[model samples]
Target: MNNNLQLYNTLSRSKEKFEPLNPPNVGMYVCGPTVYGDAHLGHARPAITFDIVFRYLMHLDYKVRYVRNITDVGHLENDADEGEDKIAKKARLEELEPMEVVKHFTDRYHKNMDQLNVLHPSIEPTASGHIIEQIELIKSILDNGYAYESEGSVYFDVKKYSNDYDYGKLSGRKLDDLLENTRTLTGQQEKKNSYDFALWKKTDPKHLMHWPSPWSEGYPGWHLECSAMGAKYLGETFDIHGGGMDLLFPHHESEIAQSNACRGHDPVHYWMHNNMITIDGQKMGKSLNNFITLDEFFSGKHKALDKAYSPMTIRFFILQAHYRSTVDFSNEALHAAEKGMQKLFNTVELIDKLTPSSNSSVDVQHFKDSLYAAMDDDFNTPIAIAQLFELSKIVNQVNDGKETLTASDILFIQNLYSVFVFEILGLISENIKGNDDQLVDQLMGAILSLRQDAKQNKDWATADKIRDELGKINIKVKDTKEGAVWNIE
Candidate 1:
């Protein structure tokens, strides 16, 4: 029992039906990292959030072409072109080349995403590689009178664009309000108006990432990369464009302006944004420096974490709250997620061990229908997970032989687990150790024999090493349960 899905649209600020541009086919784009530093927990938001979207669309039998870009160039430290490129700044700080810094951090980003089990996108183009496309977009905008060149730099004429179209449709802010409250600095002597944004910025002689353009020997503006790269790979119009809610302001907003100005149409059909991950109600961000990297959190290397959480637990925690809701990280919250994940997986594991009866104790029809309804309503994962718990209760009762399921019902339960939990939501049991106790028993008996032999010869070093190695593999071997025995740690 499957139903068509609905999701929140950031442009309209409402939950809407997820209608792809092409029937049974979709093109998706999400803004990727600047790759200047380690990937923190905050960086995992859009990656996992949109990954769920990508996975679910494929489950629906839609041919989805997902294109997430690698922003190897042209992200300014501050909002203005006068500021340094973030990658260039990191390179100078670490005494490395700009591309070297990007590669190093991008590798780390991929590793972290892999740990969280995110599927790689179909096309991942880089900003630096798409310079010709970006230049063409700038030239088109200039010819259309939406952009103008002054000295060596080109700026978008916001005031001129506003005359023809609603410049603030996505963020829902008036152009005059944006112009009024916009931060002004000493760099505006060349801009036609304070609201104008850079299209191509003139680079200083010291800049490492500069490229030759018609206006000057400069890099593309920060927003130009996404507009150019997304259009090149996904075309002038795509099905879905997603990013963190923080990008809704100037970043995504600017992309809308530059791409629409050049192409004469909106780039994305449906816009999705995942809300922020907050730490005690304050946003965990790079500029704020309140972030703990994903590696640090997993290893419990950060001073704030009480213990390391498994990657699956982290995935489940984010899913418990809807993507659009801000999930605050706390020791209590994480502990609850860990407990729930273990409980849920344990139930799924026990399903195969259960035997069915003539009649079922639980109402399978009602349970399945409610679950499908929850998912249909804007992908309400929280409610779907709650239904999973209901299934868990039935499974436990049936395992206790107080309740029963038919053979066909058991197969239905397994199918639901595979399709909805694993494929649709991208949540799977990552526990490499099999659930069977006998496997652990055979391994532990062999290991303890080695320990005993080492102990008999007074080779305490060898015995301790054996124990330490077993501990690393999550097996706790003890010297007495009559003799040394082990349990899963």
Candidate 2:
């Protein structure tokens, strides 16, 4: 197996060679979406980012049990831990049950992810389904004396946990800084320290989502579900844990503390985080109210979009940048990505049509090696994409008869494009409707045949009329030595 894979470990603040605890057995857990609304562009980053990691690991012949949880139970509004549960609030507003709201948005999230071609995780556990596990985890933490109950709510003693283990190791936050900078929320009176987070939040009588726990009738905290579910599925210690960079501070930090307090050890070996997406140099998030939903991008229904962008265009745009770098959103950038994606797909389509020569002009092995090298370096997809573009150039050159490729070279290039472009990158050609495409082909063939007859008879006016009619529909027709070619604009 290839052992040169290196990834950025947020825990250590450095890039380290990936050495799994057990060879060919990798366990990874990424924080999944909190399903309260339509998933926006900001949500796609971590999904695609960890997806690349998941794909590459499996490609390397690793048995990866990837776990991504659906937040159906306990995530609060604004991460404040005081407001109503996000799903419950939505449910109340929509006049539906809490689980009904969860089902609606969870289905929407899955649909959007499917459109993006992201693979479904091996295990997708919901917090509501694992309430027993979460309560057990909280019990373990309490037994370790890292948590305490006050006013029917259990809060993690960040001050006490910090005394035994470094509380802010993952996010590089100090306990002093957190204590000083922590905002005053409504429920601050119940905790000993301002920075101490809730393990279980006691719900009010009107709160829709509540369960019977040792502390009170309440739900688990946002951070506790991930810690509990991950440990329950991936064991106390796993290979990797990942989420957005924004989650590094209290969410992941608290996870680290809770896992240590419960199991007497760290939960994850490598910690990874993907940066956020921005719009106009400002973070594009639902809280910002400037975010565009994935559905809006696909349908071009928003006021900001000039045209609908295909799912592959969005995926390619995200992959064009390193996962750790911020991807700024703009219509112009997306349009450029659409063109580039189309060009790459066109080259791949042309590959099968090219006739082989006696000699090869491109070094196929060197190209493949460079692609793998880019992926090996922290899954540097932008560098890998650049390599693919170079290979596309070679394919174009050979197709245009400007260069040459032997039969072996043709097969290697085909396989290379198949694996990287389709499998790893998760890009696929957009499917045109079969009946519509066939109808257009038949009509174009008939029209061109009539034009040929008209030109043969020196009927220039008739041929010009046919060409002008097609042009009006945004279809450009070009005459080549082989025949006439056309494309829809």
> In order, what lDDT does every prediction score?
0.84, 0.89
TM-score of each: 0.90, 0.95
Candidate 1 regions exceeding 4 Å error are: 1-3, 79-82, 435-441, 445-473, 476-487
| Candidate 2 regions with alpha-carbon error over 4 angstroms | 79-82, 431-444, 452-478, 486-489
User: lDDT of candidate 1 vs native?
Assistant: 0.84
Native-to-model Cα distance after best TM-score fit, residue 279 in candidate 2, in Å? 0.5
Return the number of clashes found in candidate 2: 0
RMSD to true structure for each model, in Å: 4.9, 2.2
Model 2's lDDT to the true fold? 0.89
lDDT of 1 at 193: 90
Model 2: how far residue 313 lies from native, Å:
0.6
